[model samples]
Target chain A: MIAFRNVTHGYGDGPLLSDVSLTLPPGSFHFLTGPSGAGKSTFLKLCYRELMPIAGTVEIFGQDVSHMSRDAVAMARRKIGVVHQDCQFLDHLPLADNVALPLTVAGREANPEELKELLAWVGLSGHARARPPSLSGGERQRAALARAVITAPEMVLADEPTGNLDWDMSQRLLTLLVELNRMGKTILIATHDMNLIRTAKSQVAARVLRIRDRTVQHAGADL
Target chain B: MKAPLPRKFRLFGRDTRTDRVVPPSGAAAWLTLLTAAAMAFLAVFALALSVATGRLADRWSEALANGATVRISAPADQMATQTQRVLDILSVTPGVETARALDPAETQALLSPWFGPDLPVASLPIPQLIDIQETPQGFDAEGLRLRLSAEVPGATLDDHQRWRRPLVAAADRMRMLGLISLALIGAAMAAMVTLAAMAALSANGQVIRTLRLIGARDGYVARAFVRRFTTRTLTGAAAGTAVAMTAIALMPSAGDAGGFLTDIAFQGAEWLWPLTIPPLAAIVAFVATRTAALRSLRTVL
Candidate 1:
């Protein structure tokens, strides 16, 4: 769960998100929508304590982000999975190891069978031995998704999960996220994809939050 | 479901999944390895110098410690009388173990090195020399000087301290300089390794960012780099130490080179001293890399 109260953030030019207050309860599925460079990623970063709020408070799992130590942030991150549009990875490592990284870094022994199943679920079973540099964009997205949930994180924050994927691939990635939601894992995805939002809404109850005019607003019944 | 890693993958503890996160090859890796090897090589010679000077000091001290000389510079007519009086006074001196005047032939042999053997020793005004050996508790030079001045004005006591102190002091100072050189070498190695570590960390910025986003702690990230550098330094230093030790073992003995180098080598159990350099280099690399990694991780995170 994440809570942002009067949160203001920017990159020194002007306020990108100003006086924004929102509390994402446990197990809630929400989508953040905005144009390019509209501070969606910044919001997610604040959620995971990767960036500090210029004003006000941001809390993850009921703890204030400003007061958390580096290790505390790391601990919080273990329970909060992040999927990036770029799907960055240790490119030298194989796909399976990249997917299993969250567990590996968390000091949890990843079961080989379960890791294989997770890769299969994401349709990356055949590319398990392939390095990140060799994987296709869509494959990398799915691999990123697989990596995000490999540790069974309680909350998943994805920044444009299917940014570079095809429509069908996007829908497939949405379905996987929906499946995770059905498993009671909270998910917040930032995207400009209305079709994906519509597809996700039909499959499960979801809320859409739009970032505009430097604030987050509930865009319910509009999209 | 999992396949085995390649043979090269297991290098630098990549056998462990935790350590494989960072890509192993980089300029920093070789920097640390080569720096360690070169510094270790230089350090072996520095150690040899220190050890050799210390040995020199000890040998000089042992050879010159309990010995003194008496020179009679009286007129040719009185030389025998003054030499006899000097010997009689030294014979009764406490802690004087033995005192005997060298014969004319012995004196000629002593002077033969500087003056040719054909020199007329008995005709020349060469001083008569008396060799004096002392007990473990040696006689006081001031007391002996006073007695010799009153009893035999021509006789002067030479306890060897005038020249012995300077020789021993010079050797001791050389040993100190060698030790200081070794310390500087170690410090330079640490600095080189630190710079190399920072470069490696900077070059792997993407890897570090990716790892952190995946919930990896700073320590986890640092461990990957630390282990890699430490292992490289250890291996390189071991090789360097080996080569240096071999070179030292092949060096000429003390008697060779006209006794100028003065046993500049390890003797008996001293060979074990060079064996410690590799492990010490490993330790320096470990500390330097860890510190740089941790400090740089703070800034990155």
Candidate 2:
């Protein structure tokens, strides 16, 4: 669960998300909508404690992330899987290793059979030995999705996860996230794609939050 | 396809899998290795110099402690009687092992190196000298000097303090210099490793970001670099130490009579000392790389 109370953040020019207070309940699926450079990624970063807000508090799992030590932040992050839009990967590592990174960083051994099945589920079984740089954009996005859920985290915060995926691939990735939500993993995704949000709404009950005028507001049923 | 690396290795702890997280940085890794090797090579020589100078100091001290010179500077007619009195006094001394007056020819031999044989010893009013060998515990030098000054007015005891102090002190200074050189080598190794680590960390910033994105702790990420750098330093230092020891062994050894520089080497069990260089270099690498990794992680992560 994540709670941001009066959180204001910016990159020195002006406040991007100001006076924002929101709570993400457990097992809930939410979509964050905003135009380009509208602080969507910044909002996700605040949830995972990657960057602290300029003002106010951001709490994850009932603990203030600002007061968390580096180690404590790391421990908190294990429970909150984050998927970025660029979907960075260790290029030197093979696809399977990259996908299993969450489990590896958690210092838990990934069962080879389970890992093979996870790659198969992501449709990257054939690219298991391939490195990240060699993978296509769509392949990389699926791999990122597989990595995020590999640790079976309690919450999944994704920033434009399917930004590089095709329509079918995005639908498949969206279905995977919806399935995770059905399994009681909280999911929050930031995207400008209205189609993806509309399709997600049909599949599961999802609330939409829009970032505009430097604050987050409950989006109207415009889409 | 090659087999996958086993994900479960507890070699350095349960986190051995964390060791290889950093991509293999060829240039930086080699830099650490070469720096460690060079420093270790210098360290080996410094250790050898310290050991050799220590031995030289002990040898000079021992030689000085074992002997004394008593010189009689009376009129030519009274020289023999004064020399005889000096010898008699030494014979009754508690720690005197042996005492005898130097023959004119023997005394002339001692002066030949400096003054040449043209300065004839027998005709000149040169002082009569008696050589005295002492017991291990040795006689009280101050007491003996007082007795000789009073009993034989023109006789003086030279316990070799003036000669021994400077020689021993010079050797001690050389040994201290060697020790200081070793410390500097260690410091240089640390600096080199730190620079190399920083370079590697900077180059691998994306790797660190990726790892952090996947929920790795700073300690987890740091262990990867620390283990790599530490092992590389250990291996390089070991190679360098072996090569230096071999090079030193091959050098011409003049033994105790040989010139000090020519005889610089680890004697006997002292050869085991250079074996420590590798581990110490490894420790230096561990600390340096770990510090650099953590600091960089704090900045970038």
Candidate 3:
């Protein structure tokens, strides 16, 4: 669970999200819809402690993000999986190694069969030896998803995970998120895709929040 | 699943290989390795020099301190009488172990190399020499010289101190020079290692940034770089030491051949001294690279 108490975040000389207060309850799924430059990625970064809020506090599982040490933050991140839009990876490593990196950094040896199965779940089983630069956009996104959930984190935060995918690919990624939600993994996805949000809404009871005017408003059925 | 400890937190594990090896053309890596190798070689030479000088000093002190020569350069007729008087005086001394007159043949053998073997030693009036050996607490040179001057008018006592002191002083200076060379070698190693570590960190900028983004601490990142450089230095120094030892071992032996340079080698168990160089090089590289990496990472992060 994450709580942002009256968070006012902004870059120098301008406010992106001001006086925003929100709490994500345990096991709740939400969709954050915002226009360009609306601080959606910035909000997700705050949730994971990548970027501390300028004036307010963000809490994860009751621990203050602003006060956590680097190790403590890394440990906290293990419980919350994140899928960046670009899907960064150590390019020199193979796809399988990249997918198992979270486990590697955590110093846990991966069971080869389990890792293969995880890759299979993401439809990248055959591309285990492939390099990141060689993977397609959709493959990379799926690989990122596999990497994110490798630790079986309690919460999933995704920023435009399917932005570069085709309609069919987007629907597939949405299905993966929906499956994770069904398994009681809280999910918050920030995107501008209305069709994707509507499709997610039909499949599960996902509350949609729109970020505009430096505040979050309930978009409700209008989304 | 149980969370595992990070690499830095592990007490013991498999050796960590360098994550970033500069290509063969990597200027920094080659420069560091070459610099370390050169310094290690110089250190080996300095070690050999110091050991040699120590041996020389000990030999000169022991051999010269226990012996004296009384040269009786009197009128040809009185030479034998004066030699007898000087010998008698030395024989009565408490610390004198043995005193004997050197006959013509024995004195001729001492001059054989310089003057030809056909020297007319019996015809020419060479001074009568009386050699005196002493116990550990040797007879006082000044006391014996005073006694010889009163008893044998032409007797001049040579305790070899004049020659021995200069040789000892020269040996001591050589040892000091060796020590200074060793210190400079260590400084050069530390400087080269620090530069190499900085270069490696800069080259692996992306790896560092990625690690930082993933929440790695400064110590964790520093361990990787430090471990890599320390291994490299040890390996390089080992190679250098081996080459130096082999070169020294192949040097001409001191047995009637190569003169002083031959004696300039490791004595007895002194061979063990050069063995310490590689490990010492490792410790230097470890400290140098670790400090450099940690300091640079702090600024960058």
- DockQ (C-alpha based) per candidate is 0.75, 0.69, 0.26
Q: Give the alpha carbon lDDT tens digit for every residue of B182-221 in model 2.
A: 9999998999899988988999898998888677888888
lDDT of 3 by residue, B193-256 (tens): 9988888788777666555544455666777777667777888898889899889888877685
For candidate 3, lDDT tens digit of each residue in A1-223? Answer: 8999888888897889998889888778898888888988988888987677888888998998878776677678778888887787777778898787777666577789999998997788999999889999889988988888887888999998888788887887889889888999999999988899889989998998789899777776555
**Candidate 2 chain A lowest-lDDT run of ten:** A65-74
lDDT of each residue in A97-161, candidate 2, tens digit only: 88888888887889999999989988899999998999888888888888988888999998888
Which fraction of the native contacts appears in each prediction? 0.72, 0.70, 0.18
Q: In order, what lDDT does every prediction score?
A: 0.86, 0.88, 0.81
Ranking by DockQ: 1, 2, 3
Pairs of residues clashing in candidate 3 = none
Find the 10 residues in a row with the least total lDDT in model 1 chain B: B6-15
What residue runs in model 2 are displaced by over 4 Å at the alpha carbon?
A: B1-16, B74-77, B115-126
**lDDT (Cα) of model 1:** 0.86
Off by over 4 Å in 1: B1-15, B254-257, B260-262
Q: Which ten residues in a row have the lowest lDDT in candidate 3 chain A?
A: A100-109
